[model samples]
Target: MSLDNLPDGLLLEILLHLPLQSVFQCKCLSNRWCSLISTPYFTHRYVSHLHTNLQPFTLLFECKDDQSITRVLATNSDEPELKSLAAYVHRQSEHLWLEASCNDLLLWRSKDDGESSPMSVYYVINPITRQCMALPPITLPYHRSWIQAGQFRVYIVSSNTREWSESKVLCQEGFELTHFALCAVPYKSLLFWCSNSGRLLGIDPYNTRCCRSFEQPIGWELDKETDCFGVCRGYLRICQISMFYTRFSSILRIWELKDYDNEGGGKWYLEHEVSVNQLVSKKSPWLNEHVQQKYPLPLVLAFHPNDGDILYLAIELKVLLCNLRSKTVEVFCDIPHDPDTWNDKCNIINFVLPSWPTPIPFAPLQNGA
Candidate 1:
């Protein structure tokens, strides 16, 4: 019997076993194949199969430049599906800035474009399905002049809602919410925004009233510039680097949240501590020859999604993947380092690509004749 005459159930089983790229190509063979591959059941089954079989995931890096151009880099550079999605997103809106990523969905926002109002529209995009949804504009409440003594409002919206809702978050006697523009870090069902003072504002999209404040880790200094927050291997982790001026050395400490839903919030347990100076010793190739500094501080960009021991660090202009347990380092990539624009113009996003595309919830379908 010919392959075309195969039963739908058998065809789906065969297609599910193919590589992700091959499956994507199968969608273009005919309308019947396209419909078969595009069904919700197919996607769910394919994703489950990939998870059960332990398929590898790709790490996609997205950054924006001063010219409002977005650049996407992936660990698996030869993956055509991811590359195509990145290029399509770039072509759709050159000014779109990636704010956050959860699972397979990317949250992006267009630049203000010098509008008189401070609010900017947000978009949630699914690369595989090429579905885009525009969220209602949100007016920031952290404006310096708009402060109302001890309280501020946080605007939030959900995928199912068309309008934005506000929640009043009270601050301490002297503390104020100042860093509302920073990208939110999505952990489990809650989204967390970190402030310069080491405070975390967590909000639940489904429950507009469920807003909570998490204090900084015990004994942590109020230095926000050197702190990085991320989720690694099913745990919410935060990494901080401390520089010693007299000794010309730095220490990196990572903490994992124990119980996020506890009545007293969560407690951070020190998960890992590595000496940055020792990791990049004098004989290490990570040291730049041009810079004569004895100890070059490394910025923790992100943690390895699958491995808790591996970390991605940015030292000067080079990005390095360092293993804490083995004390080994490898150059991941060289990033642009323009001193003039580095501080104010750079945005980095760590995107994890699963084996199968995830369907976007509540996204409107494209019109097909």
Candidate 2:
């Protein structure tokens, strides 16, 4: 019997198991396949299956000098494996800046060879599907001014419709944009940014009117210079950097958002506090004895989606898994660092996840046809 004669149910099951790239390529084989693959029903079912077996991991983007590479490392409970994503996603002549990710969709801005600008090219892609769509230039009010004023906006590009939709504009008093530190949690339709004053600003992509703000948790002195913000499993995380001015001792405070079911209904709670002083002293007792020795601690990367007690931290050269409940820190994975560019001072490491419920497909216009 010919493959085309297969039942619709059986064909769908086969398509679901195929790599996303194969499914997309099959669309060009015939109209029947295109219509079948592009249907909302099939996309929903396929995405649901993707979510059911999602493998949450830590993503790190490393830029050594002018060259860059992306590494996707395993999280706690997973084997120590690192996959270079740039080899699969980036081109030889294109330099891409990852912006955010949602629904298995990754957003990025690309600059051509020798191009110098703040991302005039934007894209939304699903690496699993091996599909990508370019987004039109975003429309915003005073775009550059907003970036300079410490106010900014988040926008979502719909692949189904091939149009740009405004998420929200975050303009809060005393919230100055910390350039190179803004991160988005697309699963929750939220954008998180840490201000220069140790305050965190979270914006609901669904709501464009205003954003919600929270001061740094009490009892912790935030350095504002090194604190980091991130979200995992829909919980907002703030890693505060504290140092004893007189001594070289340092401390890290991890805070999470509790009761964040709605746009503005969550409150910040102190989750775990890691003693950098003890950590460093444990590593080398003689180093701590010298009061002038300063250790640059790590930043919180993301919390494990399935485990509440597990979180990842990115130190200078490695990512560590801190089991808050167990109070034990173990090596999750080691990131590659080039000694040549180690002192370049412009490198930043962050994560981009493949979330569920991929971008909604564009609905055909009824009157046009």
Which candidate number maximizes lDDT?
A: 1
For 1-369, candidate 2 gives per-residue lDDT tens digits of 677898888888988876555676788888888899989899888778777764545454444345554433343333111132344433422366655655356666664444243336776655544456667775344433333453455666655576778653645665675544555433255566776555766665546564666776667563455355665556777666677656555666777877876646777788777665444323434434331243345555555655667766655565666666655566666667632234323334433344232443333212211
> 1-369, model 1: which lDDT tens digit per residue?
877899999999999988776787798898889999999999989988878543233444444555656464535455555666566655656666667777667788877755476788888877765667888887764443534246656667756657787777655554544333356677767777655455666777677467777777775767544367777877877777777678776677788888766465687888887766556433466353322264356666677777888888765666677888876676777665532234434566666667676666545425320
TM-score between model 2 and native: 0.67
User: What's model 2's overall lDDT?
Assistant: 0.56
After superposition, which runs of candidate 1 have C-alpha atoms over 4 Å from their true positions? 21-35, 38-41, 52-70, 74-79, 89-92, 115-119, 137-150, 172-181, 222-226, 262-265, 281-295, 338-341, 361-369
Error of 1 at 187 (Å): 2.3
Best by TM-score: 1
lDDT for position 315 in model 1: 59
TM-score of the candidate numbered 1? 0.80
